[model samples]
Target chain A: MTASTDPATKEPFERVVQAHGDVVWKVCRGLLPQHDAEDAWSETFLAAMRAWDRFDGDRVRGWLVTIAHRKALDVLRAGARVETREDGPPDRAVEPPGRDLDLWAALARLPAAQRAAVVHHHLAGLPHADVAALTGSTPAAVRKAASDGVRRLRALMTEEPR
Target chain B: MTESTPTEAAMPTVPATPPQRLEALHRRLEAAATGDDAPDVHYRHLDSAVGGLLVAATEQGVVRVAFAREGEDAVLQALADRVGPRVLRTPGRLDAAAAWLEAYLAGRRQPFPLALDTRLARGFRLSVLDRLREVPYGERVTYAQLAASADAPRAVRAVGTACATNPLPIVIPCHRVTRSDGSTGAYLGGAEVKVRLLELERTGRLPD
Candidate 1:
C-alpha cells in the first residue's frame, strides 16, 4: 500500500519499473534465453512508457506482464532462435546449480504450453485465466499445464548437474 | 498458480539479477524514456546564496524554482499535480538553468537568459509577473506601481498575491517588487534574501 505500488499519486513509469521490474525480468528469462530476455525487458518498458498516459487501471503488474509476454513472443517469432539446453551456459564459467541459469535450463525443457503457463502464471504472477487468455488456452488446461510444469521443474532441478 | 508478490515470486527463489546488469538496464531505461520525452518533469538542486534552490523544468522551459524554506517534497508534489507525473531527478536536463542562477547569485543581476514557462500563474497574476520581470535587474518597484504597470492599478493586493505565488521566484525578479514604504514587503524566499538581492544589485556583493 506504499506510494511505490499504490498508484494513489498516479505513480510514474519509473516507480512502475522499480516495483515490478524483477518479476518482469523473471518472466522474460523464463520464456527466453539471457540475451533475448534482456531484449524483451528493454522493449516492454519502452513500449510501456510510450503508452503510459492512457493507462488508468491499477493492475500495473498484470499490464506489464501482458506487454512482456507479447515482446517475448515477438523475439521468438522473429527467428525462433530461442532458448534450448544446447545453447549452453553464457560464454563464462558454468553457473551454480540454484541460479537463474539452472532454473531457466529446466524451464527450457518443458512443453511450450507448460512453459508459457508456468512463466506467466507463476513467475509473472498473472492469474491462470489471464495466462490462458494470453496464450489462447482455457483456464483448466492452463492450470493443468502450470501444475505439470511445476511438477517437472521440481524433478529437473533436483537432478545431477549437467 | 499463485500471484502473491508481484515482483518476488516465492516458489523458485530466482537469484537476484547482478547489480551490474541491473544498473545497465536502468541506464538504458532512463535514456530511452528521455529519448521519447517521457520524464515529464526533470529537477535538480542548486547551491545558491539565498539557500538550496530546487529548480525544475519541463520540455517547455524552466517551470519551478523553490527555496529550501519550502520543503522539497511539497514542491515536487506541486510539479506532479500541475505539470505531469513523470517527474524524475534527472541531471543534465537543468544544467543551463543552474548556470544562469549561479551567475545571478554571483552579483551579475542579468535577466534570465532562457525560456521561462509561467503557466502556473494565470490572468492578471501572469500579467503582474510579466511586468515584474521587466522592472530591470538593478531597479525596484512598489507593488502598487507594478499593479499599475499590469493595467490593474486597483488590484494592488492581487499584485502582491501574484508575486507571492510566483513559480520562478529569483529568476523572474519578484524580489524587485517592494513596499512603497521603501521596505522589502514580502518574498517567497523571505525578506532577508530580498535585501541581499537588492544589495547585490547596488554594491555587487551579497552581505556576509
Candidate 2:
C-alpha cells in the first residue's frame, strides 16, 4: 500500500462525508423541515462528490455548508410552489407532525437570513466570514443576523403555547 | 427575566440523532456516484480458511487482496488513499472475486476469472508479477529462476521484492516463488501462509 503524505488528496471523500454529515444535517434541519432536510443533506453530499476532484478549498465544512444552503433553498422553492397550488390537500403529511413541532415552528418564524446565519455560524461552528460567504453578505451582517436570530428564538421558546 | 447570551440562545436544542437509515443513505449515494462511466472500486471482508480477507475490486477487475494480519481497516484506508476516493464497502461489487477466492481456498484450483488492475506494480516489478502467475500450482520456483523468466536474471533480489509487494497475492500465485537453496522465501502473507498454501496444493487438501 502506498503511503499518501499529501494532505490535499489524503482524505477520502467517504471520510469527508462521515466527518461532516452530522453538521450538515443540523444545518439542513435548522433551515428546512426535517423530512426535506434529509433530502437536502443527501443532495449536498452527492453534489459535493461530483465536484470533489476540483474542490481546492481548505475549509471542507464551509464548502459543504455552502452547497447545503443552495440545496435547502431549492427544496423551499419547490415547497412554495406546492403550497400555492389551489388543489393541494389541506393537510399534506409530507412529514409526520412530532414532538419537535414547536422547535421547527420557532425556527420557521425567523427570517431566512437569520436562520441561515444562526445555523451556519452558531450551530455548525463556521467562522462568521464563512457564513457570510455562504449567505452572500459581509461578516458583520452575518454576526448581526445570528445574534438577532438567537434573541428572537429565546423569546419564541419561552412564550406560553396558545 | 434572565437574559441569555446569543451563543447560549443559539445552542442547537434539537436532538442531533443521526437518521435511522444513514447506512442505507450512504450506500445509495455511493451507488449514484458510481453510476455508469466511472471506475467504481468496491470492497468487503470475507471469512476464509486463512482468516478475514479484505478484497477490493474496480469495474476493471480485482485490484487488491489483503490478508487480515495487516488489519482490514488499515488496508482499506490505504486502498482508499492510493486508489480513487470512490471506494465503497459494498460486497455485491466483489461477488466474482469472493466466489473465486472461496473456491481457491477450498482447494478447488480454480483460476481467477476476473481482470486485474496491476497499476500498483510497474516496470520490472510488474514483469516479475506477470512471470509469477505462470508458475503452475503445487510447483515451486526459486527467485533466481523467476527473475530469469522475467528476462532479468541478475535482479534476483528485485524479484524477491516484487513477490514481497505483490498487490494481488494468492491469485497471482506469488507464494510459489522460493529461495534458490530449496527453502521457502519470504511472503507478503507471512512465510507460514506460503507454506500452508503450497502444502494444500500438493495434498489437494488443507494440511491438518
Candidate 3:
C-alpha cells in the first residue's frame, strides 16, 4: 500500500508500473484472498522498484510476475508461520465448504510452479510456449504442469464425500 | 446380473458441459488486450529508451484516448495471436490522444478531450465503463457516485468492476474514481500510477 521511488531509472521505473501492473494484481488474486489482493500487489511493485535495475527489459513482464509470485509466496509462508505459532497450521482455510470452492483450494495446494503454470495458461491467455518461456521450463513441461494441475483440481472437486 | 433398485436406476446422467462461457471470457479479455494496431492508427513515439511501441485508440466519433505500450515483437506477437493479427501503425490515429494527454500532463486538460469506445464492452460492464469516463480529471469521484451517475446507485460494487475491467484506463480516467473514504482503490496500473496521475493534476508534479 506504499509507493517506492527508484532514483536512477525514473520514467522506466514508472513505465514498469504502467506496463505490467495488471499482471501483478491478477497474480495476487491467485495467491491471496480477494481482500488481501491489493496489499500483496502493492508489496510486489514496491519490491520491484527497488530491484528494477536488475530487470532485463526484454523479459520485463515475466520478470515482474516472477517477483510478484515470490512476494506472494512469502506472504503465504508468513501466514503459515503465524498459524503455526498460534494454533499449529491452518486447515479450515485450505479446506472449504463446497466443490467449486474446493477446486480453487486444490489449486492453492499445488506447488507454486504448477499453480503458476495453470494460472499463466488458463487465466492469463498466455500460450503454452510463452508460459514455458516465462517459467524457464520447456513447452512440454508447461503443458504437463497445467494438465497435472487441472487433474488434481478435478479429483478434489469430485471426491465422493462432497 | 442383479436386478437394479428403482432409486438407483432413476439417477440422471450428467450431460457434457461446454466450456463456452470461460472461452468467451478469455476471448473478450484477449480482445481488450490486443486493441487496434492498424498502421493507419496513430503511433506515439514514447521515449524510445523506454523500449516499447505505444498506441492509443479512440472511438471513431471523438479523439480523446488512453495510452498502452506493448513492447517487443514477442509480446506483441503473443497479444496479436490471442486478440487478432491485424495491426496497423498509422501516423495520426492518435491525434486527439497526443493533444489531450499533452494538455493533461501539462495541467491544462480537464474532463478529457475525447469519447471512449464502450463498444469494446457490453451490458453492465459497458454501462460502468461509460460512467467512469464521465469522471473529471484532477477531481475524484467515489465508486458510489459512479454507480449513481449510471442510475444504478445500488451497484457500487459493479462500479468498482467497471474500474477494474476498464479497457482504456487513462482516457476513461478510472484513476479519477476512488473509494468514498479517499482510499485509492485497486488500480490496473498500480496505485502508484493512480496517485501519480492524481498528484500531477493536483500539485503539478508526477511523484518522484
Candidate 4:
C-alpha cells in the first residue's frame, strides 16, 4: 500500500510562535504592566494557534500585535475602576538622578491613544496606516501620537527606576 | 512644554527588560492550542546509550522514535509533511514515554509500557512489526524466521524492509531480528546500534 503524504502541510505552529513571540511580547509589555503583559502575550498566541487556519494575512507580526493590543486593552479596561496597587515603584516616582528608569511604568502613564500608537507603530514595526486602522485613527494622527508618546516616555524615564 | 524637556542625553535609559520568560509562555500557549479546536504533535529529545534520539507523539500515543542519524530537523519536517504541521517541542507531554525508555535503556528489563501509534507502517510491513514485537528479551530471530512467524513464509525480503522501516524500532523490538547468516542486518539506526541493543538485552548491561 502506498502511504501518501498530506497534499498541503500547514506551517508548524511552533514556527509562528518563535517568529513573532518577541514583537508580540513587546507590544503587550509596552501597553500593560509586566504580569498583565505576560498574560496578554499568552492570550495572543493561544488565540493565534486556535485560529491558525483562519489566518488571512501574510503580515504575521501585524496580526499578533493586533491580538496583543486587544488583550492588553482588556486588562486596562477591566481594572480601570479598581485601584490596582501593582507591585513596584508607584506609577509616577522620582528618585536619585542616576537611577535607571522603569520603562513599563513610563508606558503605563501614557494616554491610551499614544500608548497604542507607540506599541503598534514603534515596537511592533507596524506601519502608521495599520496602526490607524487598528486604533480608528488616520495615519498622520498615528505618527503624531507615536512621536508625542515617545517624547513623554523620554521625559518620564528621566525621573527614577523603582 | 517642550519635546526636549528631558534631552536624550539627560534621560535615564530604561533598564533592560528582564530576560523573557519564553519557556513558561510557550508551555501556556501550547497547552491552550491543544484544545478542542485541534491537537498538536509534541516531541522531545532523549539522550540514550546509543545517541540523541527524537521521540514524537500525537495526542493519542507515541508515534515515531527516530535516531539522531535521521537528522532531528528533517525528521520533524517529515512528520509535519505527513502528519499535519501543528507540532511543538513540549517535553512535559511525554513524561510516561520518557521514563519508560530511560528505565529500559538503563538496564531495567521493563515491559514496553507506552502506547504506540503504528500509523506510519502499512500492509505486510505492519504485520511483520507486530510479529517481531513478540520476540522476547535476549532472543534473536532471522528475517526468514520472523517472516514465517508473520505467516508470510516466502516474504523474507519484505520482512527485512518492514523491520528497517519500523517507525518505533527500539520500542517495537526490531533490534531482535538479524540476517539469515546470523550477521546483524541493515537496521535503520545502523547495524552497530543493533549489535549494542542485542548485547544489552542478552546480558542486561550496556557495553562501554
Q: Considering every candidate listed, which one attains the maximal DockQ?
A: 4
Q: Give the candidate order by descending DockQ.
A: 4, 2, 1, 3
DockQ of each: 0.30, 0.30, 0.02, 0.37
Higher-DockQ candidate among 2 and 4? 4
Model 1: lDDT equals: 0.79
Tens digit of per-residue lDDT, candidate 2, span B42-80: 777898887778888877788899988877657766776
TM-scores of all candidate predictions against the true structure: 0.75, 0.79, 0.39, 0.83
Which is the better candidate, 3 or 4, if ranked by lDDT? 4
**Which tens-of-lDDT digit does each residue in A69-99 have in candidate 2?**
9999899888773321221232134333443
Better of 2 and 3 by lDDT: 2
Candidate 4 residue-wise lDDT, B1-208, digit = tens = 1223332333224343334457767777766655574445788889888888889889779989999998876787777667756667778888877887888877887655688888888899988988877888889999999888999899988988888788897889999998888798778888888888888898888776
Pairs that clash in candidate 3: B37-B87, B37-B88, B38-B88, B38-B89, B39-B88, B39-B89, B39-B90, B40-B90, B42-B93, B64-B114
lDDT against true structure, model 2: 0.75
Candidate 1 similarity to native, TM-score: 0.75
Q: A44-118 in candidate 3: lDDT tens per residue? A: 665565455344355666666767667766776776632112211242353344543453455566666777776
- Report the lDDT tens digits of candidate 1 across residue range B100-205: 8888888776735787888888888888888887887789899889988888889989999999999999899899888999888878888888898888888988
Query: What tens digits encode model 3's per-residue C-alpha lDDT throughout B1-208?
Result: 0112121122122122124522332233223323331211222443321122254343353221323332334333332333322222333455565566556656666736464444445788888876666666578899998888899989988778877866566667788888888788777656777777788778865665
